[model samples]
Target: MEQISTDVAIIGAGPAGMFAVFECGMLKMSCVLIDALDELGGQCVALYPEKPIYDIPAHPAIEGAALIAQLEQQIAPFGCVKLLGRQVTGLAGEAGNFTLTTSMGDKISAKAVVLAAGAGAFGPNRPPLDGLSAYEASGAVRYYVKRREDLRGKRVVIAGGGDSAVDWALALQGVAAHIAVVHRRPKFRAAPESTAQLDALAAEGKVEMVIPYQLHALHGQDGVLQAVEVVDLDGAPRKLETDVLLPFFGLATELGPIAEWGLDLAQHHVTVTPATMETSISGIFAVGDIASYPGKLKLILQGFAEAAMAAHAIYGLVNPGMALHFEHSTTKGVPG
Candidate 1:
């Protein structure tokens, strides 16, 4: 096993983790960024590369892939070591001196650790349908729409009653030939404004709302989707012919090896100090969606703030007695 050392070991290459590199770099700290995915940007690049995000500060609107590209560029000057396509399976030692073991048989030693894992090791909650894997392999069934253009002119059957389901329905309005939303309840869990927009589209005959229904079975042969079978609460079955099935039942997230690292956890999220974003264990911090505290908002922008706090707090641990005279970005420009 190869051994590496750094001032801070950052897990997860998502938006928060990527930003943490810049924050730490600005403080003259070195970082080693690690993630399970082969690529950076986490779900932004992997799931909805084409999806437009509106809440990010500065830019009024930016697509997922574009946002990640900008973050990558922002952190490029940091020269942080990136360990992709591997997971950190073991964490040992204490504050100021920690050791980590990855699944690829590599060991990392760091003075501090930051966990920016957004919904650590996340995957879609696939419906329990027969031959689901076959259709998934052939792109007949998909959990995430990586690119909207892939579904152009195709009939789509969307399942679930969350923001993802409603948002995607609205996003694919002009792109898809036809769209039918399947939900187990009439009331959606999405934002009120988005739900209202979907209702307006449905009333205008641009979308179909199949409420109080759940996915029953998939009708297809050789991984080619032909129709989707849905049933109501009373067991009434209905078949909707479609070329694709997009199930947005949310993600099945697991902390995996992170759970055994002796950190305080609440509802599968790492409980952290609100001010410093530090976990129960010293030298280890948790931020982003995988972090939880009182009145914590699961927003990317909020995670960015947390990453800054964690980096600032970690400066003391990494530098011992040295004081971190904080300077505004205007005064302390990024490394050239």
Candidate 2:
């Protein structure tokens, strides 16, 4: 088994978790960022990279993927160690000293832990259809679209009524040769403007809206899709000949082993001390959406502030009896 050690172990690689690396670096602490997902950015990259977010202070609008890219660039100078595509299954030790074991059998030792797992380990809610996994393996079906060019000139069927399904249909307006959106209801959960745009595309004959339908079966071989079978409310089945299928039902989150780590959880979120962002455990801190407190607003900016506070508290815990004179980033440049 591979073994690694660092001053702090950050348990999530989302925006807040990545920001925690910058905060810890400012305190002259090295961090090892670990996440269950194969890539960083947590919910943003894994769920909806193209979705626009308007509430991230200072920026008028930004996509989920763009925000993650900027955060990754911001922490580049710090050289934060990353351990991705693995789930942390075991946590041992205490304040100023702890060890973590992942599902891949790697062990990490650290002086402190920052649990920035936003909504815990998240995964797309797969549609219930026989042979769905086979199609996913063959690249005929996808839950998340990493690149728009991949779907260019293809017949695509999107399933869902939410932002992902609606926004993607609009995004692929000119990219895909033919795009059809299948939803169980005519109403959508996406923003008004996005829905309006999708409707405009449908009116223009560039997109097809298959309302009140659910996926019945998949026809394909070796994960390659030949067509998709969908059924309407009256059990009327229709087969859509398409090259690709995208099912964006939503995401399902689970705390997994983090729940068994002895931390107090309320509504699947870790309870933390407001002043320090420390969990029930002394050196284990929780921030971002995974951390809960009285009147806590689940915002990116709020988590950023909590990360800074947790980093300061962790610095003291990692280095006992050492006086810390905090200074602004402008005062002290990035450490080499």
The residue-by-residue lDDT of candidate 1 on 63-98, one tens digit each, is 999999999999999898999999999999999889
Clashing pairs in 2: none
* Local accuracy by lDDT, each model: 0.94, 0.91
- lDDT tens digits by residue: candidate 2, 100-138: 999999999999999999988777899889988888887
Best by lDDT: 1
TM-score of 2: 0.87
- Residue 174 of model 1 has an lDDT of 92
Of candidate 1, the 10-residue stretch with the lowest lDDT total is: 1-10
